[model samples]
Target: MFDTLIDQFWSLTLSGIALGFIYVLVSLGYTMVYGVLRMINFANSEIFMFGTFATIIISRDFLGNVDGSKTLPLPKLLLTISLCLIGSMIVSGLVAVFVELVAYRRLRARGTNKLATLISAIGISIVLSEFMRMITHSRPTLNPRILEKKSLFEIAGANFRIDTVLTIVFAAVLFFVLDRFVKFSRLGRAIRAVSMNEDASKLMGIDLNRVISATFLIGGMMSGAAAFFYTLTYENTKFNVGFTLGLAAFTAAVIGGIGNIRGAFFGGLSLGLVEVYASAVLGTQWKSVTVFVILVLVLVVKPSGIFGEAVQQTRA
Candidate 1:
């Protein structure tokens, strides 16, 4: 049994790492938005769901299909995916904006208590999830009939799927872009300032509303991209896809240290690996239960999370 496990390590580990990339990218949005706003974006999963649906609608329904099989050309397919990526981000961002504007932002404008904010977030999350179910109830739509899963090359007798490679690359690029934006961009500086001290930021002539809105937008965009990547890889989707995926990604965020961007990234990767290995050792049915147990243990030992800031020094 031990030797059997070791033999499967190379393949399973690599696959776990690749899959972890998805969680990492999506978790970033959770971390970033929470980091700045001190408010949990409960509807983030909807952002991802909408992103996948957005891409599906664009490629298959919005633009209609191509020739006999009702698909787009390679160039067009690429374009569709690209557009889906951007469109999903945009739409998700808008959805977040609306959530903020209608729910949290208004309450915030009224200076509501933290508990009230949480209640509102939960309410909105339920509404969004149910709304999605109502719209796409029980439909398992296929992804755009694009690339076949194939190997660019093999390493050490391990084969990598095209989707795996693309997911990793996309997540890396997103991390890089986000790192650059936060470190060097002016908007990023404002965000940091706002996160550090909203009152002071406001006193210093920064538009707090605008900055917070921007934070939601960024987070929404990340979730959107995650949604698109998810559907593209899996080749199918349903209205309820957001629930489990959201929970897992949210767990990753908390495990890494909620509000710490880098922590979220690693947390996501670690969670994915742990879950995959747990399934290997236990079984698929036990994967989630094992993951939750690990999360509980980690929280008991370290409430702040692996990489999260102990104090969580935020404006809140």
Candidate 2:
């Protein structure tokens, strides 16, 4: 197993990079919410799941059938994908905002216990998942392949697919844009200020509710993008699909240091690489087990995570 893995190392590495890009996008939702509210929005998985559905609906309704056999022209493919991306992002963002309003806003307004907020998030998560299941009649829906995978290039005898290359490049560009926005934009400063000290930010005249809503919106948009890419790769969607992916993404966020934006990205990439290498060495069944084991070890060694400062400091 070890020798075989070594022989196909580059192939596994590239595959891991592509998977890591998705994880990073989803993990951002987890990290961003934690950064602002000091709590996990468990419903975020559902947010991602909804984006997948949104893509399907928008494609079938507006763009017509996406035939996998015949390659779409470049302009048409780009336009179709752009529409899917917009539809998913908007739907997910709106859903996230709704979750905050319905499940979290009242609790926060009343200054309820953190446990209450956590429980509420979990409840919302369940509701959203079941709602989606009911809407799809518990059936697995297939994504229309908008971009057919063709060999983009070869690296170390591995033929990289065009879709894989595009996914990675698009994710990298978005990450850079988001990083810059968070670091330099006016609203970004407000978000940071609120994250660091809510009371201080409020004293400085920042509207807490507005900043929190914007955080959720941004996070949801990222998850929506992940959904589109994931469907593009896997070409399928199921009700429970978000659970495992969400768990992995949450683990990535924790491993990178929950609440740290850059840490989420770093941790996601690291986790992806680790999972792929481990699967190659141990076997496919052990992939998830290896990821959790690494998470435990990382937590044991550094509970605050790779980029996590003092965990206590992040809490309100």
Candidate 3:
């Protein structure tokens, strides 16, 4: 058992990091919305689900049909993947924006109670999930197995795949770019100003609605990328797929410091590592339990999050 554990170490580590990147991507949506609007967009998970479907639909169009036994030409494979990614991002982003405009905007305009907004979000979440279920008949959509799992390299007797490397590198690059944009871009400054003080930001001539919508769009885009990677890695998705994933991502956001992008990054990585190791030590069934246990511990010790700061205002 000890020898087996030692042999599996590097493989588990790589798997954890790849999975952690997906959590980071999804968690960004939760954290960004919370930072700006101080409201959890429960429906964001549906956006992710949509992205998965979008990728499947678009990739099928490009690749004709999924032939797992046949290998796609390198160029054709890359092109198909690219198209699927773009389609997923656009579809997810638009859905997120639509949700904001249709559901949350009116509530915000009316100065509705936070409870009302929360209830509205929950309703929207259910509606979206059920809608997808109706469309797909609750079937898990599969992706074309274009990139077979071939060993890219070996480290400490563990083999790493090209897919894992691509997932981590691609996600890391996007995260870095987004962090830079938020930290230095003009729109990012506007977003920060609005998050810090909505009334003051409005007084300063910042378009509050635009900033909020942009926040949702950006978050959705991240979730879309996550959706693509997830389908590519796991090869299937169901209408309710986002429920567990969204909860895990949300927990990751809280663990990292909910409202902080950097915190989400760290928190996701930590949670992924914990889940993988816990599952190995205990059982596959205990994986989710480990995540909640960490959540409880984090809440008890630092409710503000490891990287989160307390906000005086809860509503934007």
Give the whole-model CA lDDT for all candidates, comma-separated.
0.77, 0.87, 0.85
> Given candidate 3, what's the lDDT at residue 42?
92
Model 2 TM-score (2 dp):
0.95
> Over the stretch 1-316, how does candidate 2's per-residue lDDT look in tens digits?
5996889989999999999999999999998999999899899999999998888888766788556677788888888889988888888888899899989999999999999999999999999999989988999998767787889889896779988988899888888888888888888888888989899999999999999999999999999999888888898899888898888898899898988888888889988888888988999898778878877888799977887874434321
Q: What is the per-residue lDDT of model 1 for residues 59-156, given as tens digits with 9 covering 90 to 100?
A: 67776643324544588768876887888788878987887786688888989898988888888878877887787776677765555676887776
Residue 283's lDDT within candidate 1 is 73
Angstrom error at residue 163, model 2: 0.8
Model 3, TM vs. native: 0.95
User: Which portions of model 2 show Cα errors greater than 4 Å?
Assistant: 310-316
* Candidate of highest lDDT: 2
What tens-digit string does per-residue lDDT give for candidate 3 at 1-316? 2453466888888888999999999999998899899888899889899998888888776568568667778898789778888888888899899889888999999998999989998888899999999988988877777678788899886577878888899899989988888888888888888888889999999999999999999999999999988888888889999988888898899998888888889889988887777777787887777788888889899988876754333211
Residue 269 in candidate 3, Cα distance off native in Å? 0.7
Which has the better lDDT: candidate 2, or candidate 3? 2
